[model samples]
Target: MKLLSSEIKNKVLESMVKIIDRERHNIIKANKKDLDAFNREDQALFDRLVVNEAKVDGMIKAIEEVRVQNDPVGNVISDLTLDSGLKITNKTAPFGTILIIYESRPDVTIEAAVLAFKANNKILLKGGKEAINSNLILEQCWHEALVENGLSKDWIKLLHLKREETQEFLRNPSEPLDLIVPRGGERLIKFVKDHASCAVLISGRGNNFLYVAQDANWEKTLKVILNAKTDKISGCNALDKVLINKNIPNYEAKLKELQHVLRRANVNILVDENIGNILSSENKIQEEDTWYEEFLALKIVLAEVSSLDEAVEKINTYSGGHSAAILTEDKNKAAQFMEQVDSAAVYHNASTRFTDGGQMGVGAELAISTDKLHHRGPLGLKQLVTNKYYVFGDGHVRV
Candidate 1:
């Protein structure tokens, strides 16, 4: 793929912002078709699929934000004149073509494509069939933006492949795929990893954990818990597991109080044996596999940990390596926990919900990557590009 000038890329995004604003009505109408055909049983997914007036406004804002961000490509990372007089520089470069496989969330069609285009990468969106109509309309907007800027429509594409065809395509891509981001559950990540010949970035799992240290402020604990758990059940940054230190003062009373609060909020509780013994009415985690699951719903698991070490160990062992939080008044303990916790984003005295790109000041995001090889955490415009080494050598022969 040829490098696109920053002005050209921004022009496309500018066109996209205007086009999306003008076609807001059409976008919503197409989204309505999807919503009408969709089963609302999966409340989280249904929430993600809906494109209301607010969502349309959000899409326009995303493009506008990406347009203002500096171009990520060609930024020099390191420059040096070697001993042999060879001047070498490592600079950021676009990742040629990227394929993102996501479910629900028609907003991704706007966010992901905008980031990739801004960074000069060709994007191939593989959204779930549930959002076909919504995605098609969004793709049309992208094509129009490209054409309006006199760029090829090939810069952005939405794939309409079935399960079998997708698997085959991953195994044998019709065109080169520089990177593939699987932005859904573990099943989707595994599917891409197992079949895709290119680099695969794991994303969108929310088996996130929050630890309530013994020294934590009880009021703050309850507030963070409620916000992280119920604020946005469909978000990948939403909390799913809570580890309460058993040594906390008035531990038994706190456990009962927490249970009451969650019940009041209508969040289903799944307790481990220790907590189950205390919260007798709540359901026990019957399967160990439940620990590894990302509950993207109004559900949470409450478990008791004897010590901070135990909590850290459990989080690292079972979490999706996305985000983890510790509530502690002791800064030293908080720092220790943050250092030991193995996750993309670690919080101290804060909710895991702050792991979001926009909230964390990264503006619009393509995905919250859980992979460590290339990037971890929010896949923002700056994080979307790879690096290339440019070497300029004299005509002298090697020693």
Candidate 2:
């Protein structure tokens, strides 16, 4: 975290206080196309992006949330006493500027609103091509709100342009980027990690594993499988691989039934050697890439294995250290599965798709913490913070 002088910090606070009051519904009256400073292809690409109105409204509310005496950092967090006649206290502080690059999801724009506001930091958001239009509309709304509050509208930046701009922001090697977080696929994450000038936190990738128990319930298994694969195939947290223990009777039939549900949805299903079936374009599983890929479409990799141990071995080998799920009625087996799978989240009986910040009960999320340190799993408000300590004493000097 870059330490800030008290004057600059107060200026930022004053700016935020001014911006917050002006940003509500200022740009809602205009068409999203009005902010066409960028290209049309950008808007066309983002036109297909999926964002709920309620989610947009939530972003609108988040700006106001900062002014509502909310926990927007700098709050008194701790106070303590020591026997050496010392009084100690701890408080929160901002992490300076935050730059977040993510795949096309308008929801993230809303997330950025709450995140930058609550964290008391300036922010730049560069969304994926899929969310250009949605993002533009949002930026316009935000600009109007900020201007309404008597603040510079540029405090929140929306870098809407080519992919090159994203790299340019990351490649500022000499000037420096305090922190760079990439919230897209492995490819984008790798690109940012390789090129970023600042410390990179692998916000994580969404690849999960699920293994069936020896005596799994067929109906429940099918339901769980459907929800995991089809719930939101485009999300990083979607389940990617499934293992069926060979010890389970009629494993093939159960797997096939699950395949039937997927195939009916036109989802691409890939198979490996354990499937005991040949691969073709008919949704039959094949190719090792299936395990490593997050299709963001209706697709999954199907594999069969001998035991929970084998399932664990496969996941540890291929998982992106994201989330995984398992379905079984046996307590010991669930415990073992949970113990062995090295994922950010290990689900029992629930869909691997539910391994999300929103589903975990947080009102909102910045991104999935695919990284092991700093932030992991669902990234809520708590993850946006760090604590600092202060101590006081009367004429006490250390020897």
Candidate 3:
């Protein structure tokens, strides 16, 4: 694969920023078509599909942010000289081609490609059919920017394939696929992992958990819980399961208070057998699988735990390994919980929603990777490249 200079890539991105800014009305119109055809029953997916003026502005800002960041490729990671006088250097390199399969969120068509292109990687975008019109227009904008900057349209592509066709394509891609990232729910990740012949990175299944210790400030806990749960239910970092200490002062009263607050906000509450006995009016989870579910809606599960160890154990066993939080004033306990939980991101006295890329100061991101191989957090520009070693040796014969 040919490595593009940083200047040319930044030029392409600059062109994209202008093109998207100019075509905001057309983008919104195309999005409106998708909105009219989509069923709003899935509130999360519906939220992701909607693109108004603010979203268009956000897209342009994302491109601009990536355009200014230092190019990720060709940076030397390490330089070494062996005893035999063989000089070796390891340097960052592009992944060649990257395929991102995502559902809704047409902004990804801009953010994902910008980061990949800036790092000198060709990107293939496979968005859900529900957002076809929006994705097509966005792809057109990318193509125009590429052409204006004297680049190939092949650098950024939107694949239009049905479910069966996608499965077959994953099983047998005509071209080499260096990496495939599935950025949606469990079903999408599983489909890609089961069928893809290349490496697949999992993203966006966030059955995030928050543990409220007995010493936690009730006011702070309530505020964090409310914001984490209701701020944006469609977000992958949104809170899903909350475990409260059963020994907390006025534990029963606090539980009732949480129930009232949640009900007032129109958020549905599901409880385990223990919490169900107290909050009998709410729905009770019938199966254990509910613990493993990621509810990307206005729904949350309340479970009671007797100790911090139990909360840590339960979260480790059932969480998506994405994000977890512990709410307590005790620094020691917070440190213990943060160190013990096996997740990509852990929070102390904060909402899990802070696990996002932009919020974490990464600017634009491809996804929130839950995989530990290459990366375990936000997939930012610097995290997109792989390393290669170049060895130079004098002509010598083996002894």
Backbone clashes in each candidate structure, one number apiece? 0, 11, 0
Query: Mind giving the per-residue lDDT tens digits that candidate 3 earns over 211-280?
Result: 9999999999999999999999999999999999999999889999999999999999999989988998
Residues 1-399 of candidate 2 have per-residue lDDT tens digits of 434343433344344434433443332322243334335454322432544445445554543433332464666788889887888899887666677887756656656555654665566778776556666766665565556555566556787658776677677632335566687767888889877877677877666777887888878888888888777666677777888887777655666677778889777777776574623334554456667766666667777788788889999888888888788898888888898888888888888877665578654667778777777787766667666788899997776
Estimate the Cα RMSD of every predicted model relative to the unseen true structure.
1.1, 5.0, 1.0
Q: Estimate each model's TM-score.
A: 0.98, 0.81, 0.98
- Which tens-of-lDDT digit does each residue in 98-190 have in candidate 1? 998999889999988899888999999999999999999999999999999898889999998999999999999999999998877778888
The whole-model C-alpha lDDT of candidate 2 against the native structure comes to: 0.67
RMSD of 3: 1.0
Task: State each model's CA lDDT, in order.
Answer: 0.93, 0.67, 0.93
- Cα error, candidate 2, residue 1 (Å): 11
> Candidate 2 vs candidate 3: which has greater TM-score?
3
